[model samples]
Target: MTKPRTILVLGGARSGKSRHAQALAEAMTPEGCFIATAQAWDDEMRDRIARHQADRDERWTTVEAPLALADAIAEHSRSDRVLLVDCLTLWLTNMLLGEADLAAAGDALVAALEDAPCPVVLVSNEVGFGIVPDNALARRFRDAQGTLNQRLARVCDATDLVVAGLPLRLSGEK
Candidate 1:
């Protein structure tokens, strides 16, 4: 059986999205690299990062790309390596906080995934379902996140939504 070239997994926090993405990447191939986009800003974040790293075994190559996701994806993606980008929302947060160009970075990410030589799995949060935030920055983030998710989903070969630890195929078959 053939595997999907690109997949986008969307869910909330603790919704098993990253776990599911990691499993999918592991199943696709033995040589897998996890591209983490999170930055450890505090002790709690460092602990969280460590916990996520502990989940991986020896077969995983972990790369930390807190800002340059497109460059990391382009550099690591190859025929023998399956790429997994865990949590695009965090990358977006990083971009926003760093005052980077969100639109250009998002476009570059889309292009990188489109041209990847290996299969790619992207994980992101679905942050548009709840009540709107009262602050401007929060609202901007929600809007940008929704736009990015929709954009990535359009180009991906498959899209899934994890609800309560259950993955429901939103586009292609699992």
Candidate 2:
């Protein structure tokens, strides 16, 4: 059996990681599934979500899975398809604020990636490059997200960091 290809894209906000991931998926697969991990809890976020939705063409099938990302991957991944997760930061935020176990969720997600029958592309924000927050929750969130990104990168077949809209391939690219 052929090994499934997995790519992890990391960057700061508006660093073009999502767009880059989308392009990679579109180029690599005939059918693609976009697993959106964002939940619009406010008007600003709602507009941001809408803009992202509007940016894509109708060729992509989208699944709004705010927390159950592993299940979404297992359900949608196929041998001939590509699964692109738009953002993991929101998912992490949801997990952290809801008191879900980040380590458990990360393990589940990694396991799903290992068993997935299709190519998978994951996008996440790089949160550790900024100044340290002054509160406990903020510090914990930053730490968790950074750890999550590092874990995913280790398991991914390819990893890229986006800086100022430019992609710097860090590992597993020929």
Candidate 3:
């Protein structure tokens, strides 16, 4: 089956969202770029990045776009290749911590997705499953994440929720 132009893959931590995105990209095309939105601010994070890098084979080109995700998508996206954006949640966090305007960034990202010539698969954590946080910052982050996810889902041609490596299509077709 032909993949949709825009796909939003949402899941909890370790719910295999990224893996599912990777599989989607690979299924679309053997040659594609994996746009990672993770910043290695610590040793553990650096190790995690390394492990993720090792997991994907050499057929993929990896690009790290922690802040300028829209620019990265615009630069690397094309009709002949698939673009896998792994985890928008980290990108959102990076934007929030960097004090960037969330609405502006998200708008730009949405524009980019709309204009993208290739299949764009985006991974993000579904933040509404957990209990309400006690801290204000945590709550703020949750709210921002929820808003971003909803906005992206609305723009995406298809939306999937991954749980324990199984994907349930929330919108569009399975």
Candidate 4:
């Protein structure tokens, strides 16, 4: 069986990366699964999550996998469906906070993507463009995010950098 396309969408905050990823996934298949990596830790975050949920219609199925992202991808992927992973940075944060092995988690995620039978659109923040963080923890997170983005970019069939709500193809076909 042929493996479907995998796209990596990278951008800064509010850069419309999620919207672009969603559009790409929806275009591939009407029946889609939204693998959300965000966890509502506060009222503001809950509101943000609600707004994201509001963007999708009845054709989408929502699954939260803030920590078990690789397992979610492996189990939810199907030959006739598309899977949109909205924000990998959040998943990384969850792993960091939960004291999980970052390298192992990343390896498992890459393996799951390689084994997926359907199209996958992954969203992530381009967090390395700003000034260096003032604290050690912040710096570590930033570095990890950059490394994760680089690794996923290499695995993805297409990588797009979104700026000011516009997408620029960084690799693969346009």
Candidate 5:
């Protein structure tokens, strides 16, 4: 049996990461799942989430999971399915705010990907390329997110960095 293909997509805010990832998933898999990790904590966020929902086609299966992303991926991934996680940064944020075990969660997610029965597309924000933050919590979040992205990229079958609405494949492209 062929191992499942895993693609990790990374970019800064408004860098077209989600759009590129969605297109890739649609082109690669007839059966697709959209794992959303954002929670509408405020009006602005609610509107943003609604817009995202409106943008998706009816063919995609949407799962709202701010946390337990690994479990959600495990539940949805199958030999014939393509799982597209919209963003990992938000999931990480949720875990951090919830005071969940970050290292354990990260490990579980990586293990889940290794055992996934179907293709997986992970989306994440590139948060470490800008100026340093002024607060301790912000600095910690940035560091943690950067580390998480690096670890996942190392294990992904392919890694892409989206910039200015274009995807630059960094690895595993034939």
Candidate 6:
């Protein structure tokens, strides 16, 4: 059997990172699980969630892990299937808003990835590239997101940075 692998996809908003991650997971298996971290807080968010939901067909099972991402990963991982985690930034936002310990949560997520028995594709926005935020909360979130992305990149077997709908491999083989 092929060994399980973990891939981290990073990009700015509208950079096609989620779609790239989905494609990567789909290429690896006929059936997969999509672990969605987005929570519909408003109508716009609900529409975004719906669009994402519509992207996948019957071959995929959707799991919402708005906060309990590590648990979701652990529970859904299987040798015969792949897992696509679309956007960790949203997950981070949820953690911050919920007042969860960021460091502990990041550690748990990395540990889960290490122990997963299936290939996993993770999406995260590369937020550090832009100018520093004006507000304290925004700056804090950007910092946390940068740190989390760095940690995940360290653990992933491969890392890809998507730009303008193009993927550039940052580390490891394709």
lDDT of every predicted structure (CA atoms) = 0.91, 0.89, 0.89, 0.91, 0.89, 0.92
Per-residue lDDT tens digits for candidate 4, residues 103-125, read 89889999999999999999999
Per-candidate TM-scores read 0.96, 0.95, 0.95, 0.96, 0.95, 0.96
**Clash tally for model 3:** 0
Give me candidate 5's TM-score against the actual structure. Answer: 0.95
**Better structure of 4 and 5 per TM-score:** 4
Top candidate (lDDT) = 6
Pairs with steric clashes in candidate 5: none
1-174 per-residue lDDT for model 2 (tens digits): 433289999998889888888877887787788899999899999998888888876878899999999999999988888999989999999989889999999999999999998899999999998788999999999999999999999999889999988999888863
How much is 105 displaced in model 1, in angstroms? 1.1
Worst 10 residues of 2 by lDDT: 1-10
List, residue by residue over 4-82, the lDDT tens digit for candidate 3.
7788999998898888888887888778999999999999889988987887879889999999999999999878889
* Decoy 3 TM-score against native: 0.95
What tens digits encode model 6's per-residue C-alpha lDDT throughout 56-86?
Answer: 9798999999999999999999889999998
Query: What is the alpha-carbon lDDT for the whole of candidate 4?
Result: 0.91
Model 4 lDDT, residue 74, Cα = 90
Tens digits of lDDT, candidate 1, 1-174? 455789999999899998888888888888899999988899988998898889986888989999999999989987887899988999999999899988998899999998889999999999998899999999999999999999999999999999888899999866
Give residue 72's lDDT in candidate 3 (0 to 100). 96
**Residue-level lDDT for 44 in candidate 4:** 90
- C-alpha lDDT of candidate 5 relative to the true structure: 0.89
